[model samples]
Target: MFGFGKKQDQPQSTIQSEFVEDVAPAAPQVTSVSSASTPSPLMSVSSITLPGAYLHPITKDNGIEYLFINENPMGVPAGKPKERMTGSFGPLPMRTNYDKLLYGTGAAYLTGFFGGGIYGAYRGLQIAQGNSFKIRYNSVLNSIGRHGPRISNSMGVLTMGWALLDNTIYSFRGVSDYYNHISAAFLAGAIFKSTAGVRPALIAGGLMTGVVGSYGLWEQFTSEKKETKIPSLAPAPAA
Candidate 1:
């Protein structure tokens, strides 16, 4: 009876040991699961979205934050969208308006006249080196008379042609000053062709278009960046 009681006690002890081992593993697992489910305080703080935060186009998804005119907190938000900004159809303001045609034509005529007179004097000097003063004076006068009108007329015609083309473009499409300037430059190539021929015309036209277009593009890019600059979190302290 004592031996039988000993065997029965052994079986009961084995069952208790197995039960303890299984129960001990389960408690650790429960603890680990609970800890994972509860997010850390640092993580919670980082996840909170601040006011005026926005995504940047070049940044990867969820990588960076930026402010725009609408999202800037430091200043009053824009009352209207940027797309609504449009130029006027009427004459430009007094401060901005200037007579390009008059200036251009006058400048051309003056340049031509002076240039012709200078060349004539040079040629006369060359031919009259061994002659009398009277003969030299006559030679100079004759050269000036011959070349002056030709040079002056040529420059005048070119300037007028360019001005006419520019005015026409402005009349039809005056909505954007930028476009007006670009179109004028392109058309002015024709006048260049009249003097310099086809290849030169193409080169001049390309240069003008490229320069104007690049300038416009640069202005646009800078303006957009300015509009989208990040605003300060709070107003600056008054001095």
Candidate 2:
């Protein structure tokens, strides 16, 4: 009985010692993995770089200077300055849709005024050839007053419609080029003249399309030429 008891006690002690040894090795493995996964602060700081044309700010025992791309900074590319898009229509530089609308309205009003004046003058000449001077003047003034508001209302509606269509196409289809502008103008004119007559619709559409398209083309061509004459100088790429 004493020999059997000693054999059981010896096996139990050996098993506990083996279990402790296995757990000890696992602790060190876990610690090694944690240390390897940790990132160094110095490495993170050294990896950052300046973006775009902005020069990296150098802080040392010396001084500091804010350097820009075309301002002749050291180690920067030297060339002509870049041409930024003005997003303008003639003399009006539109920064928002509201600006565009306001300008469009004004342009429409001016066109209406000129058109009415021309029509009134033609009618006045016809009246002068048949009636007395007093009648001609009255007739001319009446004709001007009548045609002015009519032409203005029509033109205003057409301009607003064009703006709406242009904005819609740009928002949904991302098509805001010259062709898009011309198409929008033509479509707007057609829609405006739909109730008038077939001939009127065709005439209005053709006129609007030609005017807007030619203007856009001219602007684009001029801008391209200017850009070509002045090369754009960009800074080094950011990391």
Candidate 3:
């Protein structure tokens, strides 16, 4: 009973138990960077630029074309010729607005005077010899004939005065004066030839007058422009 009550000791090897805990190494952390993160050259610049043709299409080689560009471009217009203008001068004060008015009107009046005078004279002679109502129209015609050249000459003289003023104040040179005077003289010659009933002389004188008058006008027009004064438009300040 005593022996049975006493327990036998177990071998040291038989009582053994060990805890083996396996901790897997933390999975390798993989951080991925995208290639798209690289900046593009085009995205670096802030502004887009276009060529002139993009703004205004050009017509060349009988076809219209637009300018094409890739990448950022600096915008600049292509060289183009300017348009022509009308009237005697540009918006500048190189010449007065009506600088050429006197000369033009004078030329027209003179031409008409000579032409009318020749026609009136020829008709006058025909009416003077006839006892017809056409004679009544003759007096009216004669009145026009007598006054026509006179009015034309007077206009020429007045235009010459204006030309002198322009030439002096505006320094237009002798061009304006020459134009007015020569036009008057030629017109006077035409009238005289017509009054004398010289048909050939009338035609020749009228043609010559027109030619010389035209030449003088053209010369004045083509002459160099003179410096002109510009009137101020500014208002005076209050005192």
Best by lDDT: 2
lDDT of each structure?
A: 0.50, 0.56, 0.43
Q: Please give each candidate's TM-score.
A: 0.39, 0.53, 0.27
What overall lDDT, based on C-alpha atoms, would model 1 receive against the true structure?
A: 0.50
RMSD of 1: 23.1
Q: Which tens-of-lDDT digit does each residue in 142-196 have in candidate 2?
A: 7788777788788888888988877776667654465667888898888888889
* Count of residue pairs whose backbone atoms collide, per candidate: 0, 0, 0
Candidate 1 per-residue lDDT, tens place, 1-239, comes to 11111122233311121122121212221111123254443433222221111112222223244454434544444564232222211242111122455555676788889998898888887777557889999989888877877888767766666556656765576433556656666667555664678788878677656755675676567743332111111222332
Error of 1 at 69 (Å): 36
Estimate the TM-score for candidate 3.
0.27
The sequence of per-residue lDDT tens digits that candidate 3 reaches over residues 88-151 is 3235442332545454456557866776676566656655756677775676588567767776
TM-score, candidate 1, is 0.39
Give lDDT for model 2.
0.56
